[model samples]
Target chain A: MAEKIATREAYGETLRELGHRLDKIVVLDADLSTSTRTALFAEKFPLRFFNLGISEADMIGTAAGLAASGYIPFVSTFGVFATGRVYDQVRNSVAYTNLNVKIAASHTGLTVGEDGASHQTLEDIALMRVLPNMTVIVPADARQTACAVEAAVEHKGPVYLRLGRSKVPQVIPPGLPFEPGKAQILREGQDLAFVATGIMVGIALQAAEMLDQEGLQAAVINMHTIKPLDRELLAETARKTGAIVTAEEHSIIGGLGGAVAEALAEDYPVPLLRVGVKDVFGESGSPQALLDKFGLTADNLAAAGKRAFQKKKG
Target chain B: MPAISAATLEELRLKARQLRREIITMIYRAGSGHPGGALSVLDILVILYYKVMQIDPHNCRDPQRDRLVLSKGHACPALYAVLADRGFFPAHHLKTLRKLGSILQGHPDMRKTPGVEMSTGSLGQGLSAANGMALAARLEKARRRVYVILGDGEIQEGQIWEAALTAAHYRLDNVIAFLDYNGLQIDGWHRDVKSLAPIVEKWQSFGWHTLEVDGHDYASLLEAIRRAQMNKGAPTMIIAHTIKGKGVSFMENQINWHGRAPNEEEYTRALAELEN
Candidate 1:
């Protein structure tokens, strides 16, 4: 079994180190510093950290102001509150002006577990990606979360980085450079492609192994950046594999699945299957149970791959 | 605080009248805008740009300069007029208010307009941004002040109270906010619409130094600002009681003019009143 680390934990640790290197870095939290791991940065840089109580809208607006004043502000909260609650502020204040605000929202998707539908965020990527100047990133695991933090800060404009709660396997090895708006092929196969983001990347790799045993060669691609998506790589995957399965711990409507389908439909027509939560809210359940219920497990990805493969044949 | 000199006050009053005239003309040309709030807030903008704020249009991007966020951004005609008069840009650019590809947007866009500190059109967000500016100032150990203006109706937004709490919680003493208490929103009278009565007490409870003044009185406005500046450890809110469409005879205290552009005939009458 591979070592597992929650992306939120990695985000916290990354912020602690980045705080030392970046003098202009400021962290704001709507009273979720400890949960979002912004507490780590708050501890290191007391003056630079601002805990804005439970005011998510104010936190986002304040981050925009800080960005306007030549500060790199990383605002952290739960994904639901950060994106859904403060959509107007994110759209008008940050994205409209193209401010350097990094919205690092953690505990997204069904992995929020027993916190239930209210806490779970299955629509954040869709919301953030639609905004004009917003950069949307969903890192696959702990190692990738660090790269996301670096990329978000180094990138001059606004960035929305989606992070998760439950511990997931670290598929990307240590010391791998993270390139924004680029896709990486983890495993090479020709029959079909499993393109995934966030925690589902691990599941897609596992599903590829399962398919290989069934005499079906599958390719696994990690697409970390959802917006400014690597259309070139997606086009190549469509041309080579001829079928595509997109998996994410989000709704099938407008996440990795929606993005890949849209790209493939426009650029390279192919049989595409979206392996994710159907268009419905999640319910209270254990993390593993929720993944299984939502058809977000490796088995589900393999099934989705086979379905897409069969469609290609048809 | 010492009284503003007679000459300075008279100069500002004259400048306020000129700005009011400019506001009417710009709105008349734009074909659509919120003239009532712009006229209501003119005196305050005139005082801030001409006397109070430590800013220079030439050094608009200077780090140490004082910041002003026009929170009630629907009244951006007032702000655009003041910014143009202060030489932030060519004065002729004022004619292009709300035109496509023009810097003078219907709302204050910091990216487009020169000397506009933070892009703001949405109500209730400016105070949060002001709090951020103050926080950044404190972080840099820079002794710069941040000024924000809010509408009487805008404070009805839940985000305003959220930001008020943030300013008070963080003890942003460098942030001074003004409420354009003109007593009217688009729908009707503010009291009838949603009673923000005991408004001063509300700010007092929010851990701020609160005061009320005649919004059109430059002396009283300056005095209140002086007191706010002298205070420490918390933010301040100056609820300036103003009349909507203050300088125009027909438009004063009229809720109908809240978001209507002045027609050609009304423009002539308004300009005549301001000229007088």
Candidate 2:
């Protein structure tokens, strides 16, 4: 309904704008500045920005060094390289000591089309959230991405902010507040709820609308902050609705789906269903084709919601 | 060159020997710690920390202070001993190497210990981190120098080369690293484990100001650091040749001592050798 914008674009713009205000902020990229959109910041803050070519491990370690020296260093690369490829560097260098390093990763999820499984990073959320002292954030839209970046700057310690490559609809309203460990409940319902994250937030909204026509009310939640999860909001929504379904562009295991299930089991157990990649690697395809093939579409999410709703009554 | 009196050099040597004894005792008390690398790198750390680096134990976190990131962090018994002896912590804390709730972790944890600039253990990442510290110092124009100690076998991690290129590319003259060429690792000799032959050429090829020296020699280590500071354009990598378990008679060049603590008999023998 509105001009679509990629969250990575917002992250880049926010970084460049904030570069003028925050002198302590430094940026580093692993030879992916243009693709990751860190070039926007690099152009503005030439002295403060470092282009570490094609070396993710060194980039992470260098960023850790900068952070230890009292600078808030935001290093950018793809989600696959930022989390999985350099997991040990990120863990030992940044997370272990609780350094104030921001790992803002773009081109996340299966939406990294035509790149195949090698570039598609469906398990980065799982990889990052498992580590101690790592704050994982997945912004839903461009406006929210700006809020997430500013919030990440204020929040100290290690952060893993996931951004997207493809342009997506503006799901959240303009100027909505974004805070760490808080979920935005965009739509309300009773029978079942679709707990979604990242690009799937828009799909969940469409699913909720579809479920309402069938006389089955479904709630839509944008669970952006995966780590330090908003457990209170999740449990509250779960109690109101007897069933829950999770949606994401990531693997069903160890992503938002897994996180929601873990929290729900601990707080309020409900009949739940997870809709995402079924532990299979993504392949070369268009963004829309990949979403449709991996069962990440609204029709698929609506089908999952109906199943969860029926299972709750059963 | 700053003329070092024979007395100062001899005193540094004796202090290094005493710290070696403490390293052995601490590892034995902890029941598990690396001894070979610690013994190999102790003399270099002693010369650097005691003579070369500008660190005030009282203001360990001062922005303008010099720092040393032990990249070969398994040899931290050497670093911990140096830091404790330098009064960064109580001398009594040297008894706790890897004990529970102790400030000294198995690897370096900057948050837990004073004077430890960076948390390192997983190898190859320290030089890159040191490069960051150097870059930060340049940005602040604090004249702060960052030093790094890396193991010969540890350089096989690939991130070390990545960092080597980085320091040289950035012209980080404020950074100086010592490659502890002890020639021995856990598996065997560096030749068998991973031959880092032509290592000096490797660093020079990467645009670093490379040099070779006897790591245990106090005058040579200090001299190399001085030259590194004066280089003005590139980071320096001094390939310091050393012996594994330098002060210990039986453990010298022994691979088994690479990651293990000494037993009662070995500890007694090691202490006796150090007393000389």
Candidate 3:
């Protein structure tokens, strides 16, 4: 049975587990400990938790220095400030040198709700994925987010774990094994495939169910790792399904949708429809309103799947 | 075995002089490098590497080693010279500075350089990095100390204060930061460009144990570092009052020398004056 879990809560729970195992693991937050759910780690290991105020750049630089000294530092901040505001520090101090620092950025995509475009980082995935030696992970939901955080701690080098702020409906079952670069096949279908990451995974699953009701079976694959993208799974899915609809709660350009297209274009050319935020910034609105306004709801995914299937037929 | 040996000071001063000469020659060869800041910081580098820091050039990656971060990284010519002089690498490799394929880049690269603790160029970031190193040492229950040097102009960056506040808040005594109060930057005088006046008080207000020192005076620099080591709970910030270009006569306190290499005639005069 598939268990429902929120990614943020899972992150908090999993970090506590990792904290007990790895004494060198320290958590730093930019005054959003409670919001990002890193407060859970603070509760468990108060000594290891450092609330670095609201300075994201300083937090990253400090994490870099700590990593250089052989301490595994996990810095948590909102996606907007972590990537957009501190690109130079992340590039030079962390990624350029390949420090053993993990940046767990929450409030990713439009799902962050009323905080709006100023807070919504639709381009964070693209920004972090482009950097060399940076492992980008956008887990499906809370259960996977927890598993991903655990996996990231074990993986060497720098990893950017993109997480959502709001309580997302969990689609993955509890205790399911989560790997970094491997994609999870939720439901297999012959007509088309809905490949998604982050919050879009739930929407993709819903769309798959809707397509099944219409007598056109659609498969759903949860692609959590965006940088070391599961090309093998993408190729296999494209070959099997013959059509792909890549969905994400990020910009259509240079995101999961773009990564899938790039992979398919090179190895397996397939009819694809990218279901995500258009090339535009979001506005202040509720999460549901924002998803509807941006055409990123399950209905949009279903329509995209149908379109991709038709394109394959043509 | 004298506590204050004139012969030992004289040898360190000679090493400083040699390092300065190497800085001039390397920059002249590269046709581009910051001469003013490099000359200003040469003495401090010589004193730290030779007499102050607990380090081994042969075992640069020793976990228990004291770390030194050149926060004012544009003045890397001086750091490169001192590192080469200390035998971190061959002295002859200084000629290939700023050239492609050489380990000695325009800015310090920790991976490429033998003894650089962190790759620093963007101002005000190094202090925060140093704080992390200090905090990590404390967390691991290690006794290693971290020393960072910053340009006077570089302190204008807001991130420096952020790190400063955090260090003081955490009471990271293992970290010591030195401000090269050269009063000059790439554009012009630090005061004229952006006033960082009452700098010592500002660091004190930020909760750091602050001290003032004559940066060019080896005894004062050494004394200040010693006092900083004795500080128990708070991070130490030493305001090193120095001339922008200390050794070269015409270049002293001159803003133009901040990033300019000495021309043939200027280099001849500067070299002769140092020899004297």
Model 1: colliding residue pairs? none
- Indicate the docking level reached by candidate 2: high
Q: Tell me each candidate's i-RMS in Å.
A: 0.8, 0.6, 0.7
Measured as a fraction from 0 to 1, the native contacts recovered by model 2 come to 0.83
Which of the numbered candidates is closest to the native, going by highest DockQ?
2
Residue-by-residue lDDT tens digits, candidate 1, A96-138: 9899999999889999999999999999999999999999999
- What would the per-residue lDDT of candidate 3 be over residues B1-276, giving only the tens digit for each residue? 126479887887887787778898899888899999998888788778989888988988989999999999999999999888887898888999999999999988898989989998877789889989998899889888999999999999988988988999999999998899888888787778899978888999999999999998888888888899999999999898888888888989888888877888888888887872
For each candidate, the DockQ is 0.83, 0.89, 0.77
Could you give me the TM-score of model 1 versus the true structure?
0.99
iRMSD computed for candidate 3: 0.7
> Could you tell me which 10 consecutive residues in candidate 1 chain B have the lowest summed lDDT?
B1-10
**Model 3, residue B9: what's the lDDT?**
78
Considering only N, C-alpha and C atoms within 3 Å, which residue pairs clash in candidate 3?
A: A6-A142, A7-A142
Task: Assess every candidate by TM-score.
Answer: 0.99, 0.99, 0.96
